[model samples]
Target: MSALPRPAHGPGSRYTARAATTRPRPARDGDVAALARRLTGRDLWLARMLHEHRVLTTHQIARLAYTSARSAQRRLRTLHEHAVLDSFRPLTASGSAPEHYTLGPVGAALLAAHAGLDPTALGWRPTTTGRIAYSPSLGHDLGVNELLTHLAARTHTASGSGLALWLSERSAARRWGDIIRPDAYAHWRDGDPLLPFFLEYDTGSQPPARVEAKLTGYAAFIAATGSRPALLLHTRTASRDQTLRRRLAAAARELDLQVATSSADFTTTDPWGPWWAPLEPTAHRTTLTGLAAHWPHLSPAAGLEPTDADTPLTLPVPPLPPDLGSGS
Candidate 1:
């Protein structure tokens, strides 16, 4: 007997596409007026700078907004609290302090929509008739973060039995500075503590030169652990870099690293977060050296493991609290 045909894709994929739209939907006017006002006002100024620059520190954002760093920080807090902005840490050259306050995915979407707004005296209007107007929602960020959290928690049991660890540019740089930072770091956390499987999520905007450098970085980092680790890469569009990806894979193997072209080779979940984060240790170590190694300057966390008490990760129904704004 032949094996049952695999589901086409996704949980609802087998259902007719027409059945998907049972509920009526309202076309969003958005807070177009409010959004426009913010865009033209001080509130959106930092967002605009972040959009133009891709990322910025609170100081940089403040300079663009002509506000004090503290004021800019407050605005940043508000934006993040409202899910209007997002932030991630990147290492300073010293790898001692991590820089915060950067445009997250949600912020990027809002800025994109604002930039695409129709220019008129009547102010902004939804372009739904001709081309749809898109407004990024906190829902979107909630969804993405949820997925990331889910993958981190579930990667070990995933079909691929991979480990997932969330790592930042700074940690990555400190560990593999000789190579390159791969934008985001994801590691499958199964066997060896030192060299768990890792991957990079490249939206395909990575330059060919940069791609080579990062490929080398992964190789070096994996080699340092003296273990062969999985190194997968996913790009939104692989058309342009087919050859580059092929080269990277070959290079990874030459260094005894397993390589995958896309996350698909590794998992079946669509929302199976492409991001991975390190796990919180089950037991806290008491020594100063251990504390320093584990959480750095950050004090001991309250709860150690994932549980209902901890925020629900990856489920987007009710938006999760902003990880940064909560100031935990």
Candidate 2:
């Protein structure tokens, strides 16, 4: 028999070019103002999100902001047409990668204007989209965003369980880069007693020792700030997870750092469920919320108090968008 051809996933198949649309022209001050007036609150919120997190996939944007995938596509296409967002479809080994959206020049300008600053202050260049599209850390960045976006999307439910605070790598670095540089930081709340954690999304690209060294940084961060947010190391495979769990257990013990680990193999629709295994001899796994009960000594992270140099623009973006009464 002849070899079979692989199936294309959707209209966004890597073989097909994205549907052509009217590209936005160079944005002037008046143009930005006009675009700003045309944008809704949800649009502005998404702009702020992209500015902070760098990029989001079409599916992620849909989950975060829309009632349905079709609605998200329509709104995102319009945003791209207005130059509030720019998208790229990566060539994958198989199937298709969803359109990944980044903050466009006009969107950057809009954010700057809202903050009462020049566009230069935003440090956004015309090359921003291209840079992120080709960056080596693209997968790592996306993995981090994926985990958090799942938590952020929980707000649409009536459970009152969702991300209370989410700081991107850049935002977390700005706060505590000197001591530690977490991949991301977040406060996940199911109800009372929110679980604050620092995510370290591992792709299994680095050696186990290098991964273990990260614990030292967390130890330093705790000592310096007196904050003890749990360190979450999520890896690609079960073997890698086991290897890390064995390698880092003693280090975590010596450093007295609150550490937990999970692998993609164990993940499901509820990432907040009992997928997390603390660095101990026990085989028990716990949900993100259950971690609090596991360790009674756990406390929320500190150092979020604004410094003299901080401005309203420099503050962390809220985890969820403003409720615009549009079911977004």
Q: For this target, which candidate reaches the highest TM-score against the unseen true structure?
A: 2
TM-score of each: 0.34, 0.91
Angstrom error at residue 293, model 2 = 1.1
Report the poorest 10 consecutive residues by lDDT, candidate 2.
11-20
- Tens digits of lDDT, candidate 1, 1-328: 1111224554222212111122222223354345445432454544443332234445434433432557556656656644344443322346442223444333444555655532331122222111100112222222223233444434324444332344433334434456545433444332332223344655445576677666665556554544444444554443543555555645555654444444323333432333221222233212112222333222211112345532221111111111222221
Q: After superposition, which runs of candidate 2 have C-alpha atoms over 4 Å from their true positions?
A: 1-29
Each prediction's Cα lDDT score? Answer: 0.38, 0.81
Evaluate residue 119 in candidate 1 and report its C-alpha lDDT on the 0 to 100 scale: 35
lDDT of 2 by residue, 1-328 (tens): 1111223564223322232123443555468777888788899889999999998999988888888888888888888877888777677788878988988878888898898888898889876776676666888898889888888888787377889889999988988898889999998887776788999999999999999999999998888878789999999888999999999999999999889999889983467889999998874899887887777677777888789977656788887767535643
Clashes of each: 10, 0
Give per-model CA RMSD. Answer: 18.6, 6.0
**Model 1, C-alpha of 318: deviation from truth (Å):** 21
Candidate 2 deviates by what RMSD?
6.0
Q: How far is candidate 1 from the true structure (C-alpha RMSD, Å)?
A: 18.6
